[model samples]
Target: MPSIDLTINTDLARRILTGFIRSEIGRIGLKRAVVGLSGGVDSALSCFLAAEALGPENVLAVRMPYRTSSRESLEHAQMVIDATGVRSLTADITEMVEPYFARFPEMDKRRRGNMMARARMMVLYDQSAAFGGLVVGTSNKTEILLGYSTLYGDSAYAINPIGDLYKTQVWQLSEAVGVPEVIIKKAPTADLWAGQTDEQELGFSYREADRLLYLLVDRRYTPQECVAEGFNEAFVQAVVRRMRRNHFKRLMPPIAKLSNRTIGYDFLYLRDWGT
Candidate 1:
């Protein structure tokens, strides 16, 4: 049985991702990139790469925090800005999200959390137009595979350099790209509320998830194969079920087929589609 080790060449990965950012931003005829910083390793890695790719002055790292967001998250976001010399701003979504939240007094944590994520996205896109930057996403392969992100919110991005990377691989690249050690070592969170950690919500650590996900997704291991390779059967079933349930979140809203060349179904982006 092949063991799951998602180790990647940090230096090579950095060069490729930075190049990808530069190329994608240039393709959009923009020299600037905007990143919503959450003081997490994923976003920190994106900030570093974008700054290197588009020059620090051209990269905008926005901290869109809710009132319940942790102080450490805000500070760590600033640390990333300071380290990369990226242009930065702070947008407090507490005020922006208050109206709906005030109106719906009985909203649960999941509903409220999704609202906050979309609220931050609203701030990022407004800043994108103001700063002449494209919104770069921070989600990695593990979360993307696990459906751990809010769609059209944290998942909304003009382009993503790290979507192909696993969470464990993200930390490795972060170190090589000079991301802060403190940011790299901290527990991951959406900062939707105080005392919220991603692992606690997911009921599994990224380290464990990465290994299993690499086996299941990247290597295309069947659940039975994954179990045979040492994963607990219950855990394998649970992960598979989660992935299947959230598969729709990973795709664009489906268009009912009518014309042979429907917009999303057939009118796809092609090489040299525009100047």
Candidate 2:
């Protein structure tokens, strides 16, 4: 059994993330970032880093709230706005999604949630054009690994500073960057509906998932090895299944190869490709 340390060097991680944000956005000659503030620590940390990298005036924090979204989520989003002094706006998604819901009353919660996620991205990209900034993503490494994000919804972004950090590590960096304590302690949610939480929906806490993921993915541990290390066999299987199943979400759309210089296959150099 290997000792797993989920803790990150927040100070160093913070520096690397801020530098990453600054360079990735600037690499394309863009000086601004448009982040969807969900009032969760993931988005909050991204916003903090964006504000630091590009200055608050250059970062636009957009709050897209569905009707069922809690008042606390909205307030906490405002907390990030105030704490970072980033330019901000709120785009209510109820009107945008309600018509579709009315048209298809048979849509289940998952369907509606997916719709809301895509709708939010539509809003974010539209605002991205007006703000002249790239969309900064909010999904952390844990959610990314678990396939916990909508395909082009929450997962869509021009650059992601904390995409490598786990959910627990997101908290550590959030505190180091001065995110609100209330936000740091709150139950994480996508706010797709009232009274919904991430852990409840995922069927396990991120603390547990992160530990297991560190072994399975980072340590390259076998599933049986994880069980031998005291993790429940079923839990190990579930996480392993998700990581394997969601592998497609981690990559670009596959292109069929007929030519020898197919994009993403052999023509991999992105440098000098016209910004």
Candidate 3:
């Protein structure tokens, strides 16, 4: 395990998140944003940013809990709503996903979790349409790099403010944003299944996994180099393999390249394309 400090200064984090939302809202011409608050750090941070950028009136916090969700998670999510004063709604997705589970009771943990994520997303989108807002995502960079999220589930959103921050960095930002201390120190779990924690699902702590990820992706260290730097070879390989396998998930859907400048091909750039 690596002993690393992934903390960000309060001032710098506020600047980054505020800038991200301001830029994204302008780009999409959206005046409001809807966020799925799961009582997790990433969602808490994103909700705070949206509230800051769009004002509390324009930010809607939707809490979509399942039958298996903990009371602690529910309370923490409510705490965020109180802290930010964002318009909030609650939808219990247990009934929504019950039929699917009934059809596939033998489905594995991963599949069940994916279904839950997608169900929550569906609720978020519906609320977005009802409120004329965009769905603000909360997946952090560490999860994105390691493919820790499900496609079209937690991965799909109009804009993700914290997509560049690692999991540990998210903790720092959450604290700076005034997220409750209980949420900050709670065991990191997706609350997808009973007794399922994120680190347990990933087979490594975020501290160790995120450090290895920084060395490999941000620092451009090769496998041998990472192992040389005291990281376990097996863990390094696992992270690298996941990054490669899920490269497609990070990209826009592949185009047939019929036009001279296709969206996912040569034509796609973030630069201004004036009408």
Q: Model 2, 101-213: lDDT tens per residue? A: 99999999999999999999999999999999999999899999999989999999988898899999999989989999999999998888789999999888999999999
* Candidate 3: clashing pairs of residues: none
> Candidate 1's residue-wise lDDT over 1-275, tens digit each?
58667889888898899999999889868899999999999999999999999999999999988888999999999999999999999999989889999999999889999999998899999999999999999999989888999998899999999999989999999999999999999899887888999999998888988888888877888889988888888888878888989898898899899987997878999643884
Model 1 per-residue lDDT at 54: 94
TM-score of 1: 0.97
| lDDT score at residue 181, model 3, on the 0-100 scale | 90
**Error in Å for residue 47 of model 3:** 0.8
Q: How accurate is candidate 1 locally (lDDT)?
A: 0.91
The CA lDDT of each predicted structure is 0.91, 0.92, 0.88
TM-scores vs. true structure, each candidate = 0.97, 0.97, 0.93
State the weakest 10-residue window (summed lDDT) of model 3: 266-275
Give the better candidate number (2 or 3) by lDDT.
2
Each model's Cα RMSD = 1.2, 1.3, 2.1
